[model samples]
Target: MAYYKTNKDGDGCCSHSDGKEHSNEHIYEVHGHDKNEHYGESCGGSGTCRCEDTHKEDGVRHNGANASSKCGCGTGHGRSACGCGCEENFGSLKQTAFQFGTAAVFFILGILFAFIFYDIKLFNFLNLKLSSVFFLASWTAAGYKVLFTSFKNILRGKIFDENFLMSIATIGAFCLGEWSEGAAVMLFYNLGELVQNSAVEKSRKSIIGLMDLRPEFARIYNPEDLNGEKLINPESVKIGTLICIKPGEKIPLDGIITEGSADLDTSSMTGESLPRAVKPGDEVLAGFVNLTGVIIVKTERDVQNTAAAKMLRLIENAQNRKAKVERFITAFAKVYTPIVTAAAVLISVIPPILNSLIFSAPLNGFESFSPWISRGLVFLVISCPCAFVISVPLGYFGGIGGAAKKGILIKGADYVDALSKAGAVVLDKTGTLTNGVLSVQKIIPSKGASDTGMITAEQKEVLTYVLVAEAHSGHPIANAIRKYASENLSGTEYEEFKKADIQNYSEIAGKGISGLYKGKPLFAGTESFVSDNLNGGISRSENSLSGTRVYAAFDGKYLGCIVLSDTVKTDSEDAVKELQALGVKRIEMLTGDNEVSAKEIAEKLKIRYSANLLPHEKVERFETISSEIKAENKNNTVIFAGDGINDAPVLARADAGIAMGGVGSDAAIEAADVVLMNDNPVLIAEAVKLSRFTRKIVWENIGLAFFIKIGFLGLGAFGIADMWGAVFADVGVALLAVFNSLRAAKCRKA
Candidate 1:
């Protein structure tokens, strides 16, 4: 048995840090105590060993197994400790159902008494009828919270909310002797609210199910006794600690494999279904599942800093930032309520006075005022803005959740709105459209040198000197050259370069690396870097090559050039085509790579290209393109996608920035508005499609709510409709709009 510390911030599986009360209980394990002495009947073998002992060092004390405990901070730990928040959600739903059931019974009984026992005189108080008593009971039960909230809000100077509108309308009905209609209105409104809550909870649970990637426990590797490996909380695991990952278990943290090999399933983190094979020394991230073989890993990051944790935090915080449409609705509700309230007052007072004055009829009877007053009450009920206030935000929330399920993280609803209107798309060439992995494609020796097959004696000698220089550098080209040498050189030749002495190693950014190999000056980089050190430059013939060329020089003589290329991603062409189909008018590529390689990729993808641009120049180019696109259509937006730190500036400058999260640098992810977790270019098009669909659903809900409320308001004011019709307009229409908003959560696959 082991003991683990409690999560003080309540961000663990059991407790939610959002300040909502949860019924799930978390048990704090007690160390250095006898289990039998502290065990209680209420423990029920649920793995929670509540202790009677007080631990002063840990600042925890337990009175009994069934009793509550307090932490060092003096906050009591109750039922929020074991599971997710589902239990509390279900409990709330049950309570709403019980209240609705009780109110429904009373309302039905009152109706029965009024219709069947009309002449019978039951118990009465202060001239109140028997039916009136049952109706009052029903209203009190269903509308108590609403009435209390309305009173509190009015005292706080917040009088333009839905609760106030409902309270005034239903209380007015009861004042006019319409007890049954008043009870019915409150009962139906409660029902609608219950349905709305259930829908929202359903969407929340759906997102949780999709993103439940956190590992509960990590096995600490014990080399001396393999069978004695300890299971500990992932958050407690420190960096550089050895951890054992068994087959079928998730890698608990980002680390490099120190031993063994396996195939990993990265779909949870990247949304790609293909299994990637890895050997010792390969880097693995948290949330990736080990498919086969046990591997020992040295942790590089702690639990809270893992990629999975960052994504979860991003999704949770996304809702706090509202879109323009959502802000408009909120502002509309504030002004809309006051204006509608004024109209209701005018309808109640002005119409009857005009009729009495014009027709010369008496204005002193209850009958004359009843008709116009009833219309005003109905108008208030019809004008409640609950449908717009609740459903509009819910619609945007559903969109964000649905996009996350597909491995696309939209930072907020504002980005979703921008993505839906995307007209110009600019993409970085390397690591975005291409694989970003440089590999040796061709190696050619200097002219007049004899060669055999792909590698001659002179080529091997040239590569040996090149490797000695590159071994000191960590650039991607250096790695590619090393890999090629290792696979092609003989065992003795490889050992020769490995043991070669090199000094005065230096690197120039964006050009090449230089070192003194065996006391001879050696250079391996771009044509200018190698030629600048020589009296005469190398031939420009290599510049016509399709891939990037790196020229090497040794002892003031040209040793030849190595052609390295980064292959374009398999999906890049299809992604561009899909963007066109989605109505994106301007599609282009911007790259710091040379003109030859950039043009080759752009031609293959069938889009426009701008080559030989620096990082800042890319941003300037994007701004010019954005201006042209916006000038044509003011609503159009430009989106720039990239994965490197250099691309961070342009990613931030665009109207909406998309980052390749899987392989993207931290700076790019932070500056981006949307992150494609899969690192797949095709997901860019999928995001656009999903955004348009979500926007369509949101507008549909707005249209549905407005049409019904306006039609019913007009009907109620003219005396053609009654309180019953107003109930249908407010509660019925709200429920319909809510159900429609739920459809936005059903995202289609790319």
Candidate 2:
């Protein structure tokens, strides 16, 4: 797969659109070995359009054959059935102005004024038809449709669910001679739905905000035609298509660079602040915007089939797969709705029938049937749990929304729940506990060596040759050496760059490489390779511990050594202190670095234990801890956090593998359970606190809802609570639930 910036002659659009129906004349190649062999793919140019054919053959890389662009819709430029070519933008529902509620509020206030002017109270409104107009006005503005649907369903012999509950309760209030109360119920009920809408939109704002990282459309060039005709909607784009990207535009696809150069602000995707300079054959994600200069990209991965895209889609569907304690409410509704309907039926007719019960209790019981029916009406009015039902899920939605605002994308509700259960945390130290930047801190030169501690002319040449070779291999030490030299290199800020052409350039399978250096055959790699392959006798006894060794051999002779060590994060000690302060017991650091370096880091962080480990060694350490926790029945959980190429093994092995600051490694992101978007050491503590906060909110909402319901239900059953009191118990508790859940969103960075 590849992303490219191949421009069709965009200098003039007027001359290109003559309805000429040019065939296989505009599509030109962007990058790769063959241009004529690449097939016609989707047109990615904007306003006007151009088409190229690129095929996904065998559903794998480079296996694809070319094919013509086809829009599902049959219209001209914007003809896709998805209406994708059309000028439509997806916008989330707005919660800024609550319209559904504004209509209901104004309507309620209007009717309340009318009823006051008429001097009609609930008891007197029984015969007062003028006040019915006010009730009607309020009902229509708020819940009138729900009321009608409930009745319509009943005539069809089925209860209408939550709608039925609302209708029955409100009608019962009016029948009991409480017009104002009934109007209030419907008004507030709509307000509750508005809250529901707002809560969902909150999640929408959060979920969609992540997608904001992607561009609205793509610009594509025609491959067949020679004219510079570029098109947009940019649909029909497949992997390996080269599309020109202008400055400040979102990258349309995930691909490698093939032409031009520019600085890329990838912080939105990778969370790194520095603007990365991009040239041809470098991988670009879907969302990152190009910061400076013009860039032409050759797409390497398909637009639809990227890891970033998959992660984005996973977040959208997460809520549907799992939920919080509210799952019980949804399940209960299936049974609760029908049962509540049955209770309403019983309340309405049973009272009038029970007026003659036994003919002994209260004299003239038949004459007193109206009061019995009034009390039954109160029973129906008080039992509606409509408020509780809507707000619970709204809370969870709000929590997730809040998390996304900070760039932390949780993949599922279950992860949220699991986060709340976090009691103990384990972390991989290389990337998570430390900065993962291994540098050359010191150099030990051979006897009678130069001041920079490098030994001979042979040594410096060997060092440069070896450093440059492994620099091609991409180790942390290699990057450090490359960066240090580039910074110290006697040139302007970032010098003119070019790829070096070489002879006898060969790579040792798992080790290093041998190539021509400065017009001489040179070798740079591991000590074993230099010693055995060249069969050269060398002195290595001068170099010492605490760093990774990088050796050099120039003109078939050995040079002295340079050592690399992983640097500790500057605030790691403080981040660890905060964790320890939070009652996080047994904080430890696990690293693949050698024992000396690991011990030094652990000592600096004041950790109780330290493990200098390989991938399997870390796994063994975690297993022992897990068993110890279980044997002692400590009820403690062990979690591992890591962000490294090698930490994948330990990350998956731990209870909860948190991939912290995963900027570069694709494999680490896929392996971990949780990904901390920002590379903050303090976030480990914050995430623990967030999990605890979510749990606290969940329990608080549950306790509030249940306690209020139980208390009011008991009082209402014994006639100690009136219909108004019952309303407070049901709706009041629900409102409290929503307010309580909002706390999860309110958690702070501290």
Candidate 3:
């Protein structure tokens, strides 16, 4: 497809489609010197001319309202649009209206509550003639809606729902002559449900927002007998077909740069805030924004199997997984509800039956015992588990959304709970802690070699010729070498080389690349890559100092070496020190590189322990560390910080895995229990602190509930507290517990 040079909206020029009413004079314009024009006409007989005065030709255009269906879009002069117009937006007017409806429900319930607790019994005094029947009827209407909804789900073979629990509890209240209390409980619960419901909707919105990263379609050029060119979808755009991407548009597929260069905003993929410059021959990822310049990229893969979509699919799957705590909660609730219901029944009936044998019991007081029996029913009503059932999941929902605001995403509540006990940490050196981009530190022309002396002409020919030959390969090291020449050495004549004619060329996937240039075996790679390719008659420095090592070899001999280094993340060293201070006994560095490079990185980060290991080797190392921690100290824990991709298995294996979620792999983000979204490693400390805070809050809520229940029940058993106070012990404590538990929902990372 033919890409447009610029958008008309941006240029403010009247197109042929705009009609003659807006002429070139009336329309505002800004232009530059047209290089293709004649010097006399364009520059006005001089070296400069006003670009705004350049006139344009206008003609009739095809009659179509939208620019998409006709003109350059449908006619193959551009890309096909995949526009939703509504981006990952969670805030909208409809959402505001929903909140208002929730407020109305709470306001009405609040007023009804005031009437119940008042001395005049304002609304109740009017119901004086209606008696308890009117109270029962009011509750029946409200309570039965929940009852029917649960019944419908049950008939459809669904059970253990929170709705079922509330239905049963409200029915028990009506049977106990606590009709007013039952209605009020349902009213308040509905208010809490409204809040919980809103949170769940927001979480769903968070996930949906991520899906917008995937492109729906791409416009392709189709040559046919009837039409010279036509627009097509990315699915039909085959490999090697040139795809065009315009400014402010997402690239439809992954490909190597065949033509053009621009600053690409790839924050959508790598989460780096800066725009990365991409020129011809550089690899461009799918879903990156072309900020400027028109780039024509050849499709390297089909749209369906693009890495961007795969990453989104991984995130979706992670949300379905459950943590150990979540699984236990599910099983515990299943049995706890049934056992308590049976106990409540025995409490109401058994004591009354046993009292029949006592002769000393007052005959006049026998009637009063009925109200006490009814008090037991009110306890059962409040214990419907509605708050516990709904609020627990709601807390986790809020936690994930809060974390996303800070760019951290934990898959589930199980991860949030598991992060509290991070004991050990593991790291991958390059790309994790260090900026993956590297620059050359030194260009050793070789020992005892200088301009016009020290080395023979044969050696000079080999050095200059080999460097240019290797640079032809278009690898990362080659680019760094090219950049070095562009900066320091510019006067030397450069030989144009091609890959197809190069003899004996070979590529190693995980290591590096090498080939023949002018029949001499030329090579460039890490110390290991160069060492393996040469017999090493000339010894090279095998030990890497400061950072990573790169080398060059020719004709089974070590020629020269280049040292490249990546800058460490700003907070990496301090975060490591903080974790060690927190009593983390073991800190390991795992990588796909050799021992020397890994050790160098570990020393810089001040990590006490280290492991230079492979992808699978890291997993084995984590297993040993976790077991050793448990053996030495019962409370010892193991934590791992890694890229979410290759280290995914190890991430899922550890006691706690904290992914550099913003800078690392998607696989690690999905696998780890905790995520450091801001690329600040100090978040590891913050997460541990927050996890401990949440656990403390949970225990506080539970303890407070138990203390109030035991004290108030003891008072009622001895006739010190009235039935009204007993009800407060149940309802009042519950509201307090729910509110207190929300403190755990706070995400410090956000």
TM-score of each predicted structure versus truth: 0.86, 0.68, 0.67
True-vs-predicted CA distance for residue 76, candidate 2, Å: 19
- List model 1 lDDT by residue over 1-750, tens digit each: 334344444433222123232211334332323321121112323323334233334323442243332221111234442222333444456567787889989888899888887734555555577788788889888889899999999999999888998999999999998999999999999898788778867776666666666664689998999989987767678999999999999898988999999999987777778999989989888889999999999998887677776676666667778889999999999999999999999999988799889987888877888889999999999999988987888888788778877888888889889999999999998888999899987776777335345677777777887888787677778888888988999878877786688788788766787888768888988777899998867867567778877789998998888888999999998999999999899899998778899999999999999987867789889989999999999999999999878788998998889998643256877888888887789989988988888888889989999999999999999998899999999999889888887887888632
Which candidate, 1 or 3, has the higher TM-score?
Answer: 1
Minimum summed lDDT over a 10-residue window in model 2 is located at 84-93
lDDT of each residue in 400-484, candidate 2, tens digit only? 6566555555555556665555555676776677777777754444442456543445444444555556546566666776665
- Which has the greatest TM-score? 1
Better of 1 and 2 by TM-score: 1
- Kindly give the number of clashing pairs for every candidate: 5, 60, 6
Model 3 has an lDDT value of: 0.55
Q: What Cα-based lDDT does every candidate model obtain? A: 0.79, 0.58, 0.55
- Model 1 stretches with alpha carbons more than 4 Å out: 1-95, 111-131, 448-451, 472-474, 490-509, 514-523, 529-534, 554-558
Question: What tens-digit string does per-residue lDDT give for candidate 3 at 1-750?
Answer: 111123333332233322312211111111222211111112221222233333332211221121111111111121222121111112222343354455345445544554554323335644432324444444444445566778998899765455665666566655555555555555455545444444555554554443345553455533344234434445556788877777887888888877788999876555457898998888776778899997878888776556565545444444455545446556776776565556556555556565655644543454635654554554454345544444455455445544543445555566666666666666666556766556766544445234453434444444454455555555555566566545544354443322235566676644566777668777766566777777844444435355454566777767766656667787788878877776667777776655665666678887754444556777787788789877887666677776647667877887777777533344765577666544667767666656556555555655665677667655654446553554455456656656655555555432
Model 2 lDDT on a 0 to 1 scale: 0.58
Give RMSD to native, each candidate: 6.1, 10.7, 13.5
**Which structure is stronger by lDDT: 2 or 3?**
2
lDDT of 1: 0.79
